[model samples]
Target: MTTTGTIRSATGYLRSWVEAQAAHRRVPGVQVAIRSGDELVLSAAVGVADATTGAPLSTGHLFRIASHSKTFTATAVLRLVEAGHMRLDDPIGQFVPELEDGGSPIARVTVRELLGHQSGVIRDGQDGDFWQLGRPFPDRSGVVAEVLRAGAVHRRNEHFKYSNVGYALLGLAIESVTGSTYAEHLQASVLEPLGLTRTGAEYDPARAEEYAAGHTGLLLGEDTRQTIEHVDTRAMAAATGFWSTAEDLTAYGAAHYLGDERLLSDDSKRIMQRLESIVTAYGTEVGRYGVGMALQTVGERQLVGHSGGYPGHITLTLIDPVDRLVVSVLTNAMDGPAEDLAVGLVKVIDVALTPRTEVPPPPAGAPPLASFTGRFASLWGVLDVAELGGRLVLIRPTLTDPLPGVEELEVVDASTLRVAAQPSFGPAGELVPVQRDADGRVVSLRFGGVTSRPVDEFRRLRSGMTHLA
Candidate 1:
């Protein structure tokens, strides 16, 4: 687990990096939150909540955290199982008897299979255009009708096949057995217990303005993104219809850690996090799925969390149980880089938590580390000189994963640094001259004999340069 002191030491740089990445990636807005143990180490927002109106995004704004609802529904079902209200082996058709008619194969699909996405249920029926908002999301009768109408797509337990409809059936089963709506049960059993005041099982129209407006992606020949309206998911709420902020989402994730009895028993959490299916891409194991949970391994550390995609928002939350660390990234753009941003945070934190003994101490009379730290812009791209764990390193903030190609620095003097080490093909042994204005603020620098300047100065210089004759 990343200790509290280690996380706090990196949060200052992390915030600035997130701000730069959001602007460079052209994401309209992003919300980020981090939790270590019981403390919220960071809650930050960058860019505009509504690009059309230029409203600055804030941590208070909510995002339609679609698909994260599966975690909540899964928790509710497990709680019921613990209370002796239901069994994992029970066929789902017993609670929602509508599918038993016509001797459908879906009648034999067990609750465990649905939870693990092994039921082979259809992805979303023949016309899942509801995702595109062409029609209203299905209600109870519509959910039942879709199952009866389409039946099963493949044999049960054949392989992992994600189906939003399968979760919708679980919602119905929760209602039938508990005699309460899914929202009510979830609120009482999970949200309220976790004290996630900013989260909800569905979109609440009363707080409409508090919700970040979803936007169209940069694709589809559109020059700019247009806002999309939030509509209730109706019966599909269990699968993809929850709203939350990065802070509350991380708070919810913290409860899933083992031994945090506020949510599930450690044994149940182990069951929920066990590898039930391996998601493959081109014969490579890309990801793993547990009972309604997504499990990942990042840099020898285990992680469990989920990613959400709604009409205009893309979000992800990762929990490191061993380190007791959690990170959530929420974006109000259809093509938001939530996954990249979330993982980037983890990588940087890992770098911060690493022992500094491997990094050499500065030479005598070396200048303050902050003096040379800034963003330097060249005609080709941008590079950031940052002080992490009291060591100066050059980072390229434009790439999807920004930590690769990082170069360590050994200060030669107040205005010079030598690239001490880096990966192959990098300028591992180059002297960089730092330039400063009269106020001692960094204004320019040179890497590998290539001149770079501050962003504004570089733009001005480019605009005034004469074209080749």
Candidate 2:
């Protein structure tokens, strides 16, 4: 059975790519999910869910997505705000008064600040030793005490400071406002409506067999990986505690799309996706942060999503709003290359979906652009000239990977051409000067001080050719 669509070839390419990357990264397990609109276009998984037991990973295996839970919590908060239960500007003290009454300055932080990570709340308590798998995550009471210990790390809206503790307080505020536990409120407000059955605020002991055990020490290679313990994050679940499968998470991500009314209004979605702050997260120069997500521009495409890095898990998700594409890569290893893999997969799919220019066969006695075609070799690498949509184009070729792009070439009397709609050498545009042999046979092409000769040395014997002129 063959699949068909703009992404049909992409899934196969992605599957192989994931397989190679997982092996290269020595990650125990990996799962990827991609969706186009409401359809699940691809869900591929590789490696083992448990390196110790050698359990194969699958799209259904639950992964502790860590910080991705912030997007969920932020979504839930936005839902309440739209429902008149809360407002973005409302002071945190109004809901969870413990901090205010307890003399913690975080009470003065606004919901907007908390949602955007501008609340100036400490990221984690001083003893974030919990993340090392040495100590258990804090409970509800412990979490509140940690907030008290957290205090303020910076001034409100001063800069994009991340705060896991601030998100935990948001959870507490949700509990206080709804008179329900954070788990219950999130489940009722977000999961049920979105039909996300495989997602939850915390690990479920009932589904213990389905839960992939986290691993550590991949630095020593695959064989040396040891199973890390899994403990309930309790109150911190809202910040970094949600466990979900790749498919479910992608589905949840799709709900944030503009036309999707199943979970959030278009207005709410806009607000949540808005770039509220400039930030650098997890050592990556992420372009911006939204209400609870990260925004990046890859090539000409705008992608908005979140990255998750828990103790034994690392994941990256991206959604292309213009194309309604959602892609997620999840891995069950501390050293997993989820971000690079996810971004690369997105780019691969983007290429697969791009409509290749269709050029009718050159008319008989045509300018014979084929002379300009064929591979050219230089010190830098190999570049290919090809005809597309009846136009000559320049393309750089790679040995193992697909060509990323082709620049359209405008022929100026056969030898001189300028790049179209792109800049090559100069800021706006640059000229590509092609030199021919004495016989007017193509020999060498030069651009931006870089030169390439015909891969076929026979072309060197042509009439107008240089070096041998």
Candidate 3:
């Protein structure tokens, strides 16, 4: 179990780092939510919802959490199984008999195989132009045609092969078994039961302004990104068509924790989390997949969650079942750093929870820790000083991952911080002197001989500097 103190302290540092990193990466918008044990520790949003309009983003903004739809689909399937409506070993042809007519290899694909991505179904079919917005997403008839059109590209259970078509078939199966649409069934069975009001199986145009507009990536030597319109996924809502906020996503992740009976029994969760396939790309092991969920190893902790990649949104959610910790990071950009941000949150929490035995006390007349924290810059790069778990740490704001080679600092006096512990190459035992304005605002700080000014002041000074011979 994770202590509340640990999460609260970690989030204190994480909030500042998240805000700075989004600015540094030039990401259009980012939404993050963290849950530890039974508490919602943090909910934060940074940057703008629309780059063109510069609409400020909020925690309530919804993002297209693409492939994360699979997790919900899998949960729905398991619920049906619990009710004796379906079984994992059931063949697809039993529910959709039309699939068996064309000598399509998918006719024999089992529910379990599809759930674990072992069905050998073609990935989005040959004409997956819908992904690139060249055409609209397929309808139910089109999805069935896509499955029959390509059939199986590999032997069933040969290896893990991700297939959006496969999951779309599962959605159809759910609809057939329940006699309801996929969206309606999922809403009544899953989202409503979980009380997740901000989540939906597909895009809803009625709530347009509530959604954070997606943006194209910085592509083809273009620095500015254009907003992408939201489109209904049609028949493929199960595989890659879900919209949610970070807050709601974390709540959904929490219900997946082992032994939690809110959704499924422990027996079912064990099966869902059991390793079913090793996801590989280019002959190298990339990740591990279970029945709908993704498993990851971060430091010594094991996490289960999913990542999503929609047209203009990138999102990731990670859950530490043992500690009962959940984190979700959603971004409205084609090249959002959602995974890295989530991993950084985990690392920061780990650091906060790790016991420290040598923290020095603040010197007399020292400036408050809050007063010394801000983003500082130099010709080298940008760095942030943040107070984490009652201690101060200096982190590089420009790095995609924020935790590597983090430096700890101790209060020295009203104008200084002592580098307590850092990498050997860093200024580990030196004093960083602070310069302040008459209003008690930090103007600059010097690490050893190198001076770092407040980011705003540094930019202003650089703009006025004269060229030297």
Candidate 4:
């Protein structure tokens, strides 16, 4: 740990660093909030809400939070569960009868599976053009028909595959069980009760002037002169369509971490955060997926959180359950730079949250003689390294263009090297850690959940890299 002065300086540095990254990455707007214990440690806004209009973004500016809306949906389901209206193990088909019409039996999919993203439902929301571009958005029945027509990608409970359709179905289940529309039920059950007046799924055209204009990143191999097209996604109302502010998300995160009896029982909250499945890397448990959150360990501390991305928006929310600290970053544009900025901000917040203690000096010796240096490749791309100034310098060529060449790599330990480059960083710096073997050869790598490696290559690389650098 370090002193308060060190923490404050780190926080200030992070704030400026993230702002600079956001500007360079062409991110139109961003808002970040950090909560430690019950106190709001930091909440600030940077960049513009609408780049075309040059409107300054503020903490109060609303942005469509995209899949982050799933947390709200899950909360609504939990509220119903609290009231004994439904059980986690209840078959979703029992509530939404239409879901069972396909040859696939709905009884096989449970409420828990949907919430945990194990229902094997194909993610039909990817075909957003059909709904976003003037075509009518499907209601519950229409979405069900799409799923049946598309068919399941895998059997129910087969593995952890994220499905926006699964969540949409869960929303419909809430409606069926409560006899209310998804929005209405959510408003009555979660938002109204929590006094979150700013949160909702409705896209009010009248308020469009106040809403931030969504901006997409210019596609690669396309005309860079033409800005990525922006469109109002009213059709994604249930899957990726909910507007909120950092202030509202802070309140939501606090409710979850601090145990709000009004919304859910402490027991249920525990269940929500509990790890339901052990996700593997080379057949070893590296991470776990809970009801609607990801469970990961940073050193000895376990973090619970989730990340959301839409066409023109990206958001990340993470919680340090031990310290009751929450860090959230929201951006209005989907440009490549947003994720890196968000992840850097999370590290700064984490440093601020950590208590002052004796600082450990930088690793002794000339960077361990570069015992691990070589070429490593995965589906993610490639990592090439060489000994530089007695330390290993890793080169990640997968970074999106517009970034400087050969970014510096941070050594998590002796064996793991994480590239804190653009398009990969999150509020928690989640997309780093290019893992290597004891012999300093790359064995496996982790970016978010998906891990990649060479077949039967682990044995040859077993002693390649040492413990994280």
For residue 360, model 4's alpha carbon misses the true position, in angstroms, by: 11
Q: What digit string (tens of lDDT, one per residue) describes model 3 on residues 254-371?
A: 8988878898998888888888888888989999999999999998888989999999999999998777999999999999999999998888787667633355888867778889
Residue pairs in clash, model 1: 1-323
Q: For candidate 2, lDDT tens digit of each residue in 313-380?
A: 89888887656788888888888878878877766555445433432344545456656665676755
Best by TM-score: 1
Clashing pairs in 3: none
Q: What TM-score would every model get versus the actual structure?
A: 0.96, 0.76, 0.94, 0.69
Ranking by TM-score: 1, 3, 2, 4
Model 2 lDDT on a 0 to 1 scale: 0.77
Candidate 4, residues 1-469: lDDT per residue as tens digits? 3333333434443455456556545667788876655666567888887766677888887766777777777777887888899999998878767666655564468998988888888876536464334455566666777777774787888877777778878877877888877778878887887799667765556666656666666567432222233344333455666777777776777778745576778787787788887877678876677887777665345777767776567787777665576777887766535445544555434434442222222354424524445444554445445343323334342333212333334555654545444453431233345565565655665534544454346435545533453
The 10-residue segment of model 2 with minimum total lDDT is 353-362
Q: State the displacement of the C-alpha of residue 292, model 3, in Å, after optimal TM-score superposition.
A: 0.1
Per-model CA lDDT versus the true structure? 0.88, 0.77, 0.88, 0.63
What does each candidate score in C-alpha RMSD? 1.9, 8.6, 2.2, 13.4
